[model samples]
Target: MTSLLAILIGCLYAAAIYMMLRRSVVKLVIGLILLSNAANLLIFTAAGLERGVPPLIEEGQQVIAGTAADPLAQALILTAIVIGFGVLAFAVVLIHRACEVVQTDDMNEMKGTD
Candidate 1:
């Protein structure tokens, strides 16, 4: 499962980079979303997958007991999800306003941009 997740992360990175290089506003937004997800998955991969055990210590136990999950990874992913959503929302709103002004989704239409 870890290997599969690693492969999926690679694919996500590829797709995200590909979309990010396109010349469309919508593609850029999609790429950003993909990139954020990839990063979150990367964190998960780095944290190691420990199943069937909780990430807590019982009474009188001085350590993490068993194959407990890393709570830090979960917290990081949650924070990343919220931040990514906010950023994507802002990007979408900006894109919508730009489309209204420029009348197109092409990246080459805005003034003073090369």
Candidate 2:
């Protein structure tokens, strides 16, 4: 499972980089979304895949017993997801406004705004 995830993450990163290099604003936004997802997946991969019980402490235990999920990784991923959504929303609005003023989505054409 980890190996599969590693491969998928690699492909996502590659595709994100490729899309980001394109000349279209839409493609750039898509690339940014993909890049953020890839980063989240990378974090998950680094955190180790364990399907154990949730990270909870019993009434008399000082620390979590046996194998347990990593709360820190889950928190990080959740934060990343919220940030990614905000960035995506901002990008969409920016693209819409830029298209309205520039009348084109091509980065090359948007270079002469002055």
Distance from true location, Cα of 71 in model 1, Å: 0.3
- Clashes, model 2: 0
- Compute the lDDT for candidate 1: 0.91
- Which 10 consecutive residues of model 1 have the lowest summed lDDT? 105-114
Model 2 Cα shift for residue 78 (angstroms): 0.1
Estimate, for each residue in 1-114, the C-alpha lDDT of model 1 and write its tens digit: 999999999999999999999989999999999999999999988998767476768899898765777788999999999999999999999999998888889887665443
Worst 10-residue lDDT window, candidate 2: 48-57
Local distance difference test, candidate 2: 0.95
lDDT of 2 at 10: 96
Q: Which whole-number lDDT from 0 to 100 does residue 48 have in model 1?
A: 85
Q: Give per-residue lDDT, candidate 2, residue 78.
A: 97
Model 1 pairs whose backbones collide: none
Report how far off residue 57 is in candidate 1 (Å): 2.3
The top-ranked prediction according to lDDT is 2
lDDT of 2 by residue, 1-114 (tens): 999999999999999999999999999999999999999999998999989898889998898879998889989999999999998999999999999999999999999776
